[model samples]
Target: MMKEGGCRPRAASPLKWLTQRPTRVTRAWCSGPASPAPADLWSTLKKALFIIGSSTIVFVALRNSLTYHLQHFWGASGDFWQHQWDKILHTYGDNPFTFMVYGTTIVSYVVYWTVGLLYTFVDMTGYPAILKRYKIQPGTNEPVETWKLIKCILWVNFNQIFVGVPFSMACFYLLRLRGWDESRQLPTFHWVIIELIICILMEEIGFYYSHRLFHHRMLYKHFHKMHHEWQSPISITAIYAHPLEHALSNMMPVFLGPLLMGSHVATIWLWVSLALLSTLNAHSGYHLPFFPSPEAHDFHHLKFNQCYGVLGVLDLLHGTDDKFRASKCFSRHLMMLSLVPPREAYPDVLPKGKVIRGKQCYDQPSEDSQ
Candidate 1:
């Protein structure tokens, strides 16, 4: 058998084998034989509960502390809540609501922008290598252009702080002026949680329909196509869209539940902040194990007309993700690997597309296809 050419079958390298069989490791780490077993689901739920619970606790404590300091600073010595209100009334008189709206807007901006900056710093500095390693399926790793990023930021701010907030405040003041709300008691923690859940459900429903509509040929070009410019997106890309799209799809869904519930102002602030954080986390390209993966949503961005929901529940029910599943890229195993920098980034691995769906890759023929 020691015949002609000593061409023996080469042993597969460990890296090659892992790349070929990435799902094997993912299944062992995050699931069972079935797709995301009960244990896996429970683990994700527990993590979310812990984060929300812990953050709420810290936020309440800090707010109380700050209020106390502010009251003392103003030389007020009386009931805490009464003292703060009295001070605001004394200072702003008939325009207290104006000040309240301005304060909330400014505070929300500070929180949202602070979180955005931190994520940017982390990805740009310490974790660039880490981001590359675990990036979902191979795609572009190059940074988005500064001008494009600026456009996204400016448009988002214009919609959120300028248009959305003032419109919301006007509606709220009108409702109060008309004496529509009846229940005027301090809200309990249970009420906040319930309202938060309602808000999420509303977002899931509203965003699902609005997103699907935006993908239609008639509306896509005018309203939502600009957001599709980035096939592989970063965290800041979450709010990057036309102003009307932001209003219809992003802001309205989030605020609808709170508005209907007449939720406590504190609960509204907390829920809005959390929703912003959630969206930012979703658009963030990294797929850390402890955190929920952005693979599904990111896949939607990479491959249009699929997974068009705030959460995947609606998509699953409607079979919107079937094509994504068939692509072999939507596996949980690949999502878990999304945290690691790829062995090689896109272009080296495979060609990109204007839109990629299952076996077919399509080019942007017109503005609508973008």
Candidate 2:
């Protein structure tokens, strides 16, 4: 304690160490699950079951999503998925998010499938029944044909698949030859887990800014408007953005990997999961007890230029959340007004509103699940 460098020791502080080694323990722990923790077996079972169930729900929706450009692009395994999975089985790590148990690729598939079907219904007769039933606040009243909307959706997602798939495969092959992806299949699970977490952090930063850019007034009028078509009424229109916007938004995860570290399959899987979940949920349009809903995004669509992040934090940090604050404040005021007389616990009426242009407010909507 009395040493000259005692206050400024070379040894790192615990927090610093943990921060540096995010996978510190996970890597060590997964070497082999040989030493069983003495915790109740039932408890571990419950936790495992919970994780599996949650991952399944997300995957189911994502898996059902593939009806865009190719009605029969792959072949006769069953659908395109059969062909895709066959490829994945033959090349496990090579098959996109196969390595990621709750992979984003699957989730994206769900998102596309769900939206495609929804638009299909509305397109045949031009009725957004789904949107009308659940949407919080109404955005544009433009009549979007179902088939037309599908085409837009296809163009956007396909942009990523066409470009990013090849892009990733190229990167993967290059990284492998350089002997990068080869050594990490069994990285201390801890490091793998840590790397996953780090990838999330990095992607969050990348996505937040990228999402906000599309909201810029100039950009909004161009391709972005295509997406915000059905605000209150949930529409397949979520990913129906102009191809440029879609390309940029969907590829945030891909862009982040190299900036922070070498390209790794683990990183890709983790990134895919986060992106798919956030994107799909953002547009899932279903309000849940635990998570934010499409209405959360309905708010943004009604009043663009706010609500930016996948989860909604960046806006708060960057002094951009005033729109959300002011809207919530007014809505709360409206609730108070609707109250005073009866005070019966009010029903939630604040989903979205008629579209309105305004100052950039709300730090940024967390489009994480959008």
Candidate 3:
């Protein structure tokens, strides 16, 4: 069981702390080789097909209806965008590689730090009573020292600057050599939508398999353990990982789809921005009103396993999310519609006698209260 502050007892020495094995409690929650048999292949495949089919149908329907309108809008604003593009190309020596490198880097950091700092502020202050009540793992953030947060920030920046940029440069060079286009013309809305859908699917597959692989006994300690240090993660912790894990699991999956498709620099920029925002929200640890619940990923951190995929489809297929599916957090996964605390908004999921705002909700509560 986790201690009061949701942390394990610290080792006497820093080296020991770094090298210590997971406790029995942690092992129990992990989806190692000893876990129960996964769902039958046929059934899992059927579910996957159903999900894909339904999503495709919905997207096609929307595309059919909205494509023309979107195309019209783009056509209307074509000149403005064309001028902007020309200015960018002219200023950047007409080099798509330079444009992509600078543009994506700026956009990614802007979105990451802008949203990350907001969530960090919330964690630090626990302000705006409504947001505080929605804290998934109450009291976990309380013990995080300011120095530790600074270290996390510094490490994340170091990885991005030294590791991420070079990887991106190399990938872009390979892609160009592979005949990837650097067309000056903007892509149609229809093609952009199609490419984005493909990218999302590819990312899901790549991330699911790679993440599960990293959790293997031999690899976890070396490559992925650093990331799990934040069981109750804040937004910035989304990229706080070992450099190898960052390159393989975090960066590779995202770039895989775009690279294969030979996507335009602008499209890549947009995709990276959206992907960064999605991750920031997932790791933000708040189920704020009007936003998708971060409960799935939050539970992943707390338990050290399960909910291993972004869209949950792969987890459902491999039976990795069986425990998560049975948990109260699953029921509470919908986007929240109110500013009220989760304890109030999702009373059914809250254990009886669990304290919320200093009051017990029921007379008898489960010992393992969230």
Please, what's the RMSD in Å of model 1? 14.2
Candidate 3 lDDT at 284 equals 86
lDDT of 1 by residue, 173-207 (tens): 75466543233233544456578878888888888
Question: Relative to the unseen true structure, what is the C-alpha lDDT of residue 123 in candidate 2, on a scale of 0 to 100?
Answer: 38
Candidate 1 ranges beyond 4 A from true positions: 1-96, 122-128, 137-141, 174-185, 333-370
- What is the model-wide C-alpha lDDT for candidate 2? 0.48
Q: What overall lDDT goes with each candidate model? A: 0.63, 0.48, 0.76
How should the candidates be ordered by lDDT, best one leading? 3, 1, 2
Residue-level lDDT of model 2, residues 220-282, one tens digit each, is 788677776655433455556666675577564444654355545545554565555555556
lDDT (C-alpha) at residue 312 in model 1: 73
Could you list the CA RMSD of all candidates, in the order they appear?
Answer: 14.2, 16.3, 8.3
If candidate 3 were superposed on the true structure by all CA atoms, what would the RMSD be? Answer: 8.3
- Highest TM-score scorer: 3
For model 1, state the Cα shift of residue 365 in Å: 30
Candidate 3 per-residue lDDT, tens place, 1-370, comes to 5555354543344533222233344534443333322335568779989988998799788976678787777667657666777787777776777766766777788889999998888788766555767777666685357987998999899778787788788878878877675888776677888888888888998898888878887899998999998877889999999999998999899998789889988889888888898899999877777887887888788777778888888887766776676666676788877667665666644454655432122222346753
Better of 2 and 3 by lDDT: 3
Per-candidate TM equals 0.63, 0.51, 0.81
